[model samples]
Target: MARLVARRGRWFIILPPLLFLFVFFLIPFAFALKISFGEAALRIPPFTDLFGRGADGHLHWQASLANYRYLLTDDVYVVAVLYSLRTAFFATLMCLMVGYPMAYAMARATKSTQNILMMVIILPFWTSFLLRVYALESIIRDNGLLNAVLLQLGLIDHPLRMMHTTFAIYLGIVYSYLPFMVLPLYATLEKLDRTLLEAASDLGGRPWRAFFDVTLPLSMPGVIAGSMLVFIPAIGEYVIPALLGGPDNLMIGRVLWDEFFGNHDWPVASAVAIAFLVLLAGPIAIHQYYQVRQVEY
Candidate 1:
């Protein structure tokens, strides 16, 4: 009876989130998939019928795979996918480089200092994210504060063109996503046993050597977690790239947006989104399979 009750309790905990995903994620994905197989139309809902009544009064399905085919053959969309992946990769790398040091410093600090540092790290969340991005935009604009200060200091004769560039996009991503990287790293580093580092030192390992041999290997979980958090969202990012990137910056998110809203091509947009999900899911699934295998070994 106790075992049965525990099994029921486990299902009770799992049921809510499963229901939520079904309603919110799976249902929407079904609609998107249905739409992707539709033809573009000038009328309401913007896509042609998926099914119709035939002359014999029998239901007939009218689905097309042309949208997916177009996505595959189009150089524009292919370039957007590649560029989005490249930008997300670099952004994740930057976040890891910056966040790891900050996390390590916080982990090594005294309790009081750690609390203060954590507050500083989280303070950005108090304000609106859009507002923060806008503030960054203001600072980097041609006639903005950064250029004004540099011009005043005689560092340049003209205001530097910083906004609407790849640099701006990278800056926005790193700034916005830094907290995601740091928190996981801090969680892992904080729980790490200090005795291991001490033992390494006792065995004649230098500080850097101890860190490389002891600390890094132990923190692999956090590193992977943080990288995934940053990379996944960065790939689908639309606002930062929209606000900060140039016309040449063709991220997949931007391409999706332009297809849906700019061109009002819902079928193409749905196809892009479905293809993007498949592209992301493949790597993540492979990574998880390898991680499980490593743990078992």
Candidate 2:
């Protein structure tokens, strides 16, 4: 009875979290899945209506795949998907380029310097995220400091368009997600075996060669991890696009938002969401594979 009581006590602790996940997470997901296939009206109850069966009197819970087909055929959605993919790709690349060197420098710093550098990276995050984005707008606007400097230097005759464009979007993405890349890359690179590089150098490998031949390969796990971290949520990002993207640079997140909130088409919105998930499956699968490889090693 005591043993059973202990097991029951453990279950009591475990069940709450599991139940919480099921109720808050899984149930909503299942509901969304239902919404994806349901017959829907724009801004109406029957917000999503369940399908009915034919004369045989059988229940047909199967959702029509027409929503998926519609998304594929829609030119706007297609273009948005492409834009989202392109933005995310460039953002990830820029983050890696900027983050790798910074992370390496921080990792190689003296203990106190490392702490200071880490704090510097974290300092931006201490502010409200929306406010920081607003600050970026101030910095990158046509009359912003960058344009003022360029104009003063005679680089341009007029203040350049900077606030609302694809470039601004890229700038925002890099600024927002750079720390995510740096922190993980720093963690991995810091733990790297320095003696191995030293040994490689002693064995006649030059510094550049040693880095390419030794350090880079070893840091692959961190690169993959950080890239995945930045890339995944980035594809679904709405805030940065809304803030920085021009009218022409329609990204998937914006499209999803338009469907859900603007057009009030919950079924189509859910379908768009499903399509986004499908598009993301490739990168996610690759990330998962790399994670498995990391685990194996």
Q: Report the lDDT of model 2 for residue 149.
A: 93
Q: Candidate 2 lDDT, tens digit per residue, 40-146?
A: 66445646457667579987655677777788888999999888888999999999999999999988999899989999998886877778777899888988889
What is the per-residue lDDT of model 1 for residues 60-87, given as tens digits with 9 covering 90 to 100?
9999999999998989999998999999
Per-model CA lDDT versus the true structure: 0.91, 0.87
Q: Which clashing pairs does model 2 show?
A: none
- Point out where model 2 deviates above 4 Å: 1-5, 42-46, 51-62, 285-297
Model 1 clashing residue pairs (backbone): none
TM-score of structure candidate 1: 0.90
